[model samples]
Target chain A: SQKIEQNSEALNIQEGKTATLTCNYTNYSPAYLQWYRQDPGRGPVFLLLIRENEKEKRKERLKVTFDTTLKQSLFHITASQPADSATYLCAPSRGSARQLTFGSGTQLTVLP
Target chain B: GAGVSQSPSNKVTEKGKDVELRCDPISGHTALYWYRQRLGQGLEFLIYFQGNSAPDKSGLPSDRFSAERTGESVSTLTIQRTQQEDSAVYLCASSVSGDPSNQPQHFGDGTRLSIL
Candidate 1:
């Protein structure tokens, strides 16, 4: 079975610090990985996406690194702020499946 | 332009009652998807629609749940004899295309359904 594991525990960090979240998968290698931010009572918003061939992708303060060999992806929020406090989800895409398998996600709290 | 939109941000109904949820995808988006998110859980894919092709209903939990899209526009998800387990946030997302390798999905605020 294909499984994606993310840190279920909440992460607390001070504002302006870097927050790193990990997403590990088992069973098969995904063609691409994506990160999303979801707030309470709202749907998820796309953050960044990284392909299997590329090592890293950056958008503003967000960065995503995909390591197919280890079947893990790392999501980083640089200079985080209180507004950045939300649940971050990692979804890996299977080849030609047209659907993404999402992980449980990690709750991140950036305190001011 | 408006993003994906769902109707009845909050819905409350009694068990065994039938309910319908609506989703209006982004204008000109060729692909649409539906998902369910339980409290403190990850999003579960429910179905996908692309162009005029047959929908992918592989993720539907049971036959009691069904969905339909017409003319590549609005979609409605119907739950017959809804059970308590059907209570969850139903989300709708739309993308430029159904190909996951390229297009990214844009989501709606979702309709939070509660069954008593």
Candidate 2:
């Protein structure tokens, strides 16, 4: 069976600091990986995507790195603010499969 | 352009009853998907449909779960004899095609189902 794991523990960080989240997977080689931000009672919003062949991808204050050798991906949010608090999910997709297998996700709380 | 949209944003039903969830994909999108998210858990793939081809229903948990897509547009997920464990937020997403390596899926505010 394939499994995706994110840091299940909640992360608390001071505002204006950098927050890093980790995602690891076993028994799968996804063609692409993606990150999504989900707020309470809302659907996940697509954030950034990185391909297995790509080392890194960035969008504004967000950055993601995919290391196929380690089967891990790291998501970083810089200058985090209180409004940036939400659960971050890492999803990896297999080629020709429309669905993505998501990790458990990490809850990030940026305290003021 | 409109994003994916789901109806009956919230549903509460008795156990053993049947429930149907609807999803309207973005116009012109060739692929649609359904997922389930339990409280405090990650999204679980449920089903996938591409164009007019047969859907990939491997992810459905049991025979009680089924879904249908018409003309590459609207879709419906039906659960028969719902169980308490079936309570979760049912999500629907769609992309220009079934290949996620090339296109990103657009999600809709899911229908939160509560089986009492």
Candidate 3:
């Protein structure tokens, strides 16, 4: 069985600073990883995706890194703002077209 | 029309009752997925639908839970004899296909199920 772990505690950071969240997996080798932002009471919204062969992926101020060797992925929000606060989830999937295994997610709070 | 849509934004049902939640995927998407998010827990994959058939149902928790899709568009997840443990937000997502790389899934607002 495959398992995914993420930072369980909420991350409080000052606005305009960078926030980094980590996602680690065990007993699985996925072909790609995805990041999503989920607001309270709302479903997750896709943010970025990075393949196993890709080292990094960036969209706007969001950046995601995939390290197959470490079995980990890091999601970074640069120039974080209050609006950027949300629960960040990392999903790693194995096959080309299959369901993804998601982590519990890290709640990010950007304080002004 | 633009994004995945789920009905009964909130569902309040009594234990031992049955509940049906609906999901309308994007117009052209061929893959649909159902998930449950319990309080303080991560999203748990319930089932996946490709076209009109479910190829992966490994995440369904029990026999009481079942889902069906038709016309490769609308999907309904039914819970029979629901229990308190079945209380969670039911989310639906769809994508062009479940491509492992670069394909991002769009999610619906979700149906908040509260079993009392």
Best by lDDT: 1
Classified by CAPRI criteria, candidate 2 counts as: medium
How good is the docking of model 1, by CAPRI class? medium
Task: Please give the lDDT score at residue B24 for candidate 1.
Answer: 95
The TM-scores of chain A alone, one per candidate, are 0.97, 0.97, 0.96
Clash number for candidate 2: 0
Model 1 C-alpha lDDT versus the unseen true structure: 0.91
Per DockQ, what order, best first? Answer: 1, 2, 3
Interface RMSD score of each model: 1.2, 1.5, 1.8
**Distance from true location, Cα of B47 in model 2, Å:** 0.5
Query: Scoring model 1 with DockQ, what do you get?
Result: 0.75
B1-116 in candidate 2: lDDT tens per residue? 47889989999999999999999999999888899999988898999888988888989999999999989889999999999999999999888864765577789999999999
Rank the candidate models, highest lDDT first: 1, 2, 3
Q: Give lDDT tens digits, candidate 1, residues A1-112.
A: 9999998789999999999999999998888888999999999998887888999999999989999989999999999999999999999987687677789899999999
Per-residue lDDT for A25-78 in model 3, tens only? 999898888899999988899988888999998898988999999999999899
Q: How good is chain A of candidate 1, measured by TM-score?
A: 0.97
Question: Which regions of candidate 3 fall more than 4 Å away from where they truly are?
Answer: B98-102
